[model samples]
Target: MNVAPNNHKTGKEADTASVANYRVDNFTRLVTYSPRFLLMLLILPVLSGLVSVLLPAFGWAPALEQTRFGVQGFMALWQTPGLTQMIGLSVTSGFISTLLAFLMTLMILAAFFNSVWLNRIERLFSPILVIPHAAAAIAVGFLIAPSGMFSRLISPWLSNWELAPQGILPHDAYGISIILGLTLKEMPFLLLMALGVLAQPELGKKLRQQHKVALNLGYYPMTAFFKVVLPNLYPLLRLPLFAILAYASASVEIPLILGPNTPPTLAVAIVQWFNDVDLNLRIKASAGAVLQLVLTAGLLVLWLAGEKLVKVLCNNSITNGRRKYHDKVWQTATIGLTIVILGFVLLALIGLFLWSVAGYWRFPATLPEQFVLLHFQNSFMQMSTPLFNTLTIGFITTLFAITLTLLCLESEQLTTKAISPFTHLIIYLPLIVPSIAFLFGLVWLQQLLNNQTAFLNVAFTHLLFVLPYTFLSLSSSYRRLDPRFANVAASLGATPSKIFFQVKLPQLFAPILIAVALGLAVSFGQYLPTLLAGGGRIATITTEAVTLANGASRRTSAVYAMIQMVLPLIGFALAWILPKYWFKGAKA
Candidate 1:
């Protein structure tokens, strides 16, 4: 009788194990092939956009009733005034800004790689990242403008001038101001990427060991980092550097604000062409878009060549076997640059706040004569619609992006297979390609498809940009999570889905929130995508701010820019605060 009962119990246990295995296998099969399909979905739009633009460049657009393909568009593009100057400006500004940001990133790492100062700088990254590019450009312009805050602070005491000085600071011919603005924005990104790499436990330990070995050999700390650690670190940074180069080369917003007007950068000029009342200019604009694409690619190629040159040049120093050199000057300079760059950003933001409330403020006064909410009150009625649209799009775009990213990452974990290198490149396509190039084409294609301008279309376009950033933000934390927790849960009869939701998701709450904030920021900063995708029907704070920035009303523009800056900051704050409160409640 006892033998019979024991046998029945064993049979029941076996059945349970079999069912669990079946569920796990079913889940694995479902997600295994999803990535390939998702990759196609992501790539098709970019390819279609490129094709749509290509036909117009050849003077063939059926919508325009000119099906004959020829070189008319290219010829018109070449004939445009200041064409050469626009291309030259784009190339120079892109290269100079990227180079400066990269060097500064290295200097900061060398000076305070594992120190408290480094930690402090890292803390400031969130605020800087939250500030939209348009807002930042406006703030930077105000702070550095000839009669702006910096000048007012030093005028009577040092310069002895009462009236605002006439100087072409922000809109200088060579685009110096554009470069400064780009550098301030790009450094945080590059530094963040580097820090992520350094934060990997195994890699960080190895780097520490290598750093120590070099120091023991009598090499100075800074020199040791360049010779030993940089070779490893730089390869990982190559993709981000390329992405930065692409943006700096063809960016429309900063250039629109700070670039010369006689002939803006190629990208900016293309926008003007597309927006012109003369419809024939659309074909020319298409050609310019194609040229801008080629220009950005050429810039990347040149950057690659520069990379080789730098490697060879640095290799000579490594061979010299120099043990010690005076690094104090270099360290001091690094610290000073860090302070100036951070100070400039802080003061620029403050300048925006002051301008928003100033009443009859003059050039030589650091403070407004009398602060008032008159500007805000005047702008509120106009600002209401754009603010609603911005929030709606930002939330919708972020939600979908986070969901898709989670699926992709979860699929990776389930299959125990990472995406191939080629697939990874495809995901980064939206970022590496200049938005002006494909977006210009996409706008025309949307018209051809009779796709109405709506929030869904705008959100979809925003997803193309937002998804990559979201994945990058959350992937590291997700992948590094311990497997034991899942194993233990599975042993308790949990299904794959259950472990994913209850076991894994809870552990990843903070990172998920962070990714959400990053997605919102990326969406909020989009200017061209929103304007083009929505066919000018959609007005986000970014688009409105950019428009107002170019207008004569500084106070009204400040009001819009301030709103743009605040939305992302609010997202980041929620990400930080929610986790603490939720976990505290759980503990209680």
Candidate 2:
């Protein structure tokens, strides 16, 4: 009997060990396959959104009871007055702004690279990067409009008259004001992206060495950069530039404030169609959205063609061996222009702050005659709903984005296989496609699901955008993580999961926090997605600020814009500080 009892105990121990081993194997497989699963999850909604838009364009949406395909929707869109102008504006503004922003980014970097001013310039632009596009446009309008602050300051004195000059650029029919707004906003982004690209230490050193060789071979500094460094740099920046091109083309808020209204940019027009009281206009809006997508794609193709042509021209120039170009003049001009742009941006922001406090200042005066707290006091109560919605939506979306992004990134690191190029393109699709196009489709989708809560729907839509940017911001840091630390922990008998939680995440606390902050900023600044997906039921600070900009209430508008700008600033400030607090010895 004793021998039989001992045999039973040994059998139970063996069974338990077998089960545990199976579970461990399952988990390892899960970690290895997580990226593909996550990517499929991200792609499904986008594909559905696109299909939903395309169906309506073809006059076949079940929600509106158009069960058969027809071209009626497209017919209506084409027949609309000023459609040509709208597309033209969208195209020109996108291409021109992107071109200028790209050039300015290269020039400024060339001028400041390895200089004492390099770090300082980057830090100074941090706040500029945080400023909301709507707020910037509003502030720019306040300064440059016909009866604007600039006129208030210099008016008749500079003009040798007693009245203000007609605003030359503020709402010019050619969309000049819109271009300026886009260029200013996009420059910081391009610069940030370029700086990120240059982060690899060895790559940086190699480029510097190549630059020296060219200089020694009698190549001008700028020429050497254009010939030697640019070939490598452009490929890295292509994704960001394409994103800029897409954004510039389809932007809603900035163009609405600064662009001409005869036929506003295609994005603005499409938005108006959806917003129209007549619900059938939504079909037309969907059609317009499809056209906008086509237009954007065309512009991208053109950009690629332009790249080829430019490359051929550059090769010829390099072959001619013109080594004595005027690089000093180019450098000085670039630095001077960048400084002026920054100065104007600073002044525009100050104007927003000042207007928020002004009591009743008349035009043609440099400063406010009397400042008061009335605007702030009046705004405090009315701003509650929008502010609440903004906070709730921002938090939820940022949480979702950060969680998903971390999972996919961690899985990629743990996996033996490399993440594919196609996966990278999927990550960028949202940034490249016009939001005005996909967001309306999302609206119809919500209706089909009978989704009533604006807050949830809006947050989900924001997540689509927030994820791409969050992923981009955190990716480089995550990939470049030194594996030696984890290897050391493993040698000490730590399991992979334990090492990841204990060693990897703690070391990466700073980047993780920074990514969250950037995601929050992206979510906070979103206007179109919030406006459309929320169906006007949900209001955020951005929607309110843009609405306020439409009227003659300068002080109240300024208060709203100031409020809009402040939220992101608060998020970024926390990002900058909390990383140091958590990881005391780690760099933020």
- Winning model by TM-score: 1
lDDT score at residue 108, model 1, on the 0-100 scale: 95
**What digit string (tens of lDDT, one per residue) describes model 2 on residues 367-408?**
789999999999998989989999889999998888777767
Native-referenced Cα lDDT, model 2 = 0.84
| Model 2: worst 10 consecutive residues (lDDT sum) | 1-10
What does each candidate score in C-alpha RMSD?
Answer: 2.6, 3.4
* Count of clashes, each model: 0, 1
RMSD to the native, candidate 1?
Answer: 2.6
Stretch of 10 with least lDDT, candidate 1: 1-10
Please write out the lDDT profile of model 1 over residues 451-550, one tens digit for every residue. Answer: 7656777887898899889988988898899999999998997888789889999999999999999999999999989987897889989999999999
